[model samples]
Target: MNLKSFPDEHLQSLTSLEYMWISYCPSMDNSFPCGLWPPNLSNLSIGSLKKPISEWGQQNFPTTLVTLILYGENSGAIPFAKADDTRNTATTSSFLLPPSLTYLYISDFMDMESLSMGLQHLTCLEELVIISCPNLKDLPVTLLPSLSRFWVNYCPKLRKKCSRKGKYWPIISQIPDLDILKAGRT
Candidate 1:
């Protein structure tokens, strides 16, 4: 796709658009303005853009949205567009997430080292899936009580850290359904 930018509030007119996927947008240099998103949009998959979502600053996504999937690149994802284990509280989070989400997926962020930085605000989350983040070193110390299903795959560090006897096991062990697959196998 050759998209570079869209006028502010351009997409707000489409009230019937329930889902939006903005992937493979390497040429996109800017983000959608606060009021530009479709009013009823529910599912959003955003990634592969010039700027990682972590550094997009505070965002105001649709309240009707429930599922979110972010595909990462080899680059980082935080301040200055680099990821780290900041452990900032929900009140000082670097990026804001849609609080109404029920399912969230993060994948392929080779330089990312943590997930807790952006996960604290989701009180309605029910499922979380992480995949292919080979360098990720930590999972949330405490998942929201609403979450019941969790999965991770191809994340070498996570597999080792979340294993039965691994250090982070206790954090994820309480989820009702959990699965961690070996790297390069699935």
Candidate 2:
């Protein structure tokens, strides 16, 4: 924890601080606060923190957030598209998450290719996990048929576009707990 200057009210006294898991902490670079979070933060796992999350410009998460985890540290090629300084640049950047989400996890983004719809504000997303993100290709095919649980591991182009005749498998092929993990299987 080589913390380098994080002084935005510094967690604001725990008000029953719901699960917060700040990960790897690459020298604890001075981002991670747009305001004091953790006023009942329902479960957040902000990532490796070398000042990515697209420069951490605006994040205010505390609508009792429902389980969000991200562990990408190689810096953003599109780590949920941040840097929205009142729409001043970066191609009208959007995707600011926390629409009272219901579990979202993305891991080890080694230069993400596409999370393209930027999850469209997560519309009560029921559960999504993509681990180890090996050059992830694309998802957010209209949020994967309103996912009731979907996982993709080690993403070799999302295990070849979610296989079974590919091209995203007819939009997650009626997902009711679909899990696609090949290409180094977990």
Candidate 3:
């Protein structure tokens, strides 16, 4: 039985990889390699893994990662703790995220808050979509200047607020160039 996670023996020569779908690897503890990646990797969709993302893992992510889609049952704060095993100490929040990321979609993250705030670092990000996150009450005001498209669906409680102009809107006016769709609107 082949228990190795990476199908290919070496990724050294590979310069670019597109649209990778990785799922259901029981022994795969970490997501990406510790260092080095496809220089042009853009679209990445990963799901169904046990190990959470560590602080060390974040510092070596692909700089070219553009669109990221994460689907899983692990819904909590961003999982990068100091000292790898210790969960108490507060470490510097500088994780190596994709610099060129444009779109991000996170589903079933019921209690996520920091991501909305941390995403301000992705200066090139344009669109963000979140669904089924019942615990998300407020979005950080920092994600406005460059974000153009925003969509939040199936979050019933998020729809009760009114815009600054007194119109019933789910998301607030903070989304500078948003194409917002209310629940009842077609």
Candidate 4:
């Protein structure tokens, strides 16, 4: 279905919703409605969003969220503070994620260059998947102690960096399962 606008009242009423998938809705222009998300929401998937990742922050994210999936060719960067932004910058970013998150999937972001360091906050994250983002280049250096599975597909530069002998190997080598798919392969 085509949704042009999502009203706050409509979203606030789904207090018991656990999973929601909104895709193929090009007419929607707003970041997932802030402060209107149900407290019990655990999984959310949004596709074809034109808004920047910077527009979604802690306030909009449900603390109960466990999985997040974003797919859109027009999506923007995953906002995070720079490592050098502070003296003790190992964990400092205005961009906050819910601690309950376990899986994160992002795809088709044509303009993305790097993942935000803010992801380090997801201490409970177990799986991460990035697909079809051609411009992505780097990943955060912070260790994801709980991450057991990592997957990347159709990201040329990122694939090169994550190679066995590449610069990103040290960062991802600890993961129990790692899959890197080249272009044209599933």
List the candidates' TM-scores in order: 0.77, 0.36, 0.64, 0.80
Candidate topping lDDT: 2
Off by over 4 Å in 2: 1-3, 7-39, 43-45, 51-65, 75-101, 110-125, 129-132, 135-146, 149-154, 165-172, 176-186
Q: Rank the candidates by lDDT, best first.
A: 2, 4, 1, 3
Q: What is the model-wide C-alpha lDDT for candidate 3?
A: 0.54
Cα lDDT of model 2 by residue, 1-186, tens digit: 776655546685778878877778787775654545868879988777777766665455777889888887776654354323345343433346666888888888777778855576677888998888788888778767888889888878778889898998988878889888775533
Candidate 4 local lDDT, residue 150: 92
Model 4: CA > 4 A from native: 33-35, 50-59, 80-95, 184-186
Minimum summed lDDT over a 10-residue window in model 2 is located at 81-90
Candidate 3 has its poorest 10 consecutive residues by lDDT at 80-89
| Model 4 residue 84 distance off true place after TM-score fit, in angstroms | 14
Worst 10 residues of 4 by lDDT: 84-93
Which lDDT tens digits does candidate 3 get at residues 33-148?
34355566688766445554332243334777898876554535444222222232234333445658898876665555445444556778788776665555555455545567
lDDT per residue (tens digit) for residues 1-186 in model 4:
467766644775788999988766777676653435777899988767545444644234678899998776565665554323343332222344577889999888777788846565667888999998888887766644357999999888889988888888877888898888766222
Judging by lDDT, tell me the better candidate of 1 and 3. Answer: 1
Shift of residue 48 alpha carbon in model 2, Å? 4.1
After superposing candidate 3 on the true structure, give the runs of residues whose Cα lies further than 4 Å from its correct spot: 1-4, 7-13, 24-30, 33-36, 53-56, 80-95, 156-186
Candidate 2 residue-wise lDDT at 179 = 85
Please, what is the whole-model Cα lDDT of each candidate in the order they appear? 0.71, 0.73, 0.54, 0.71
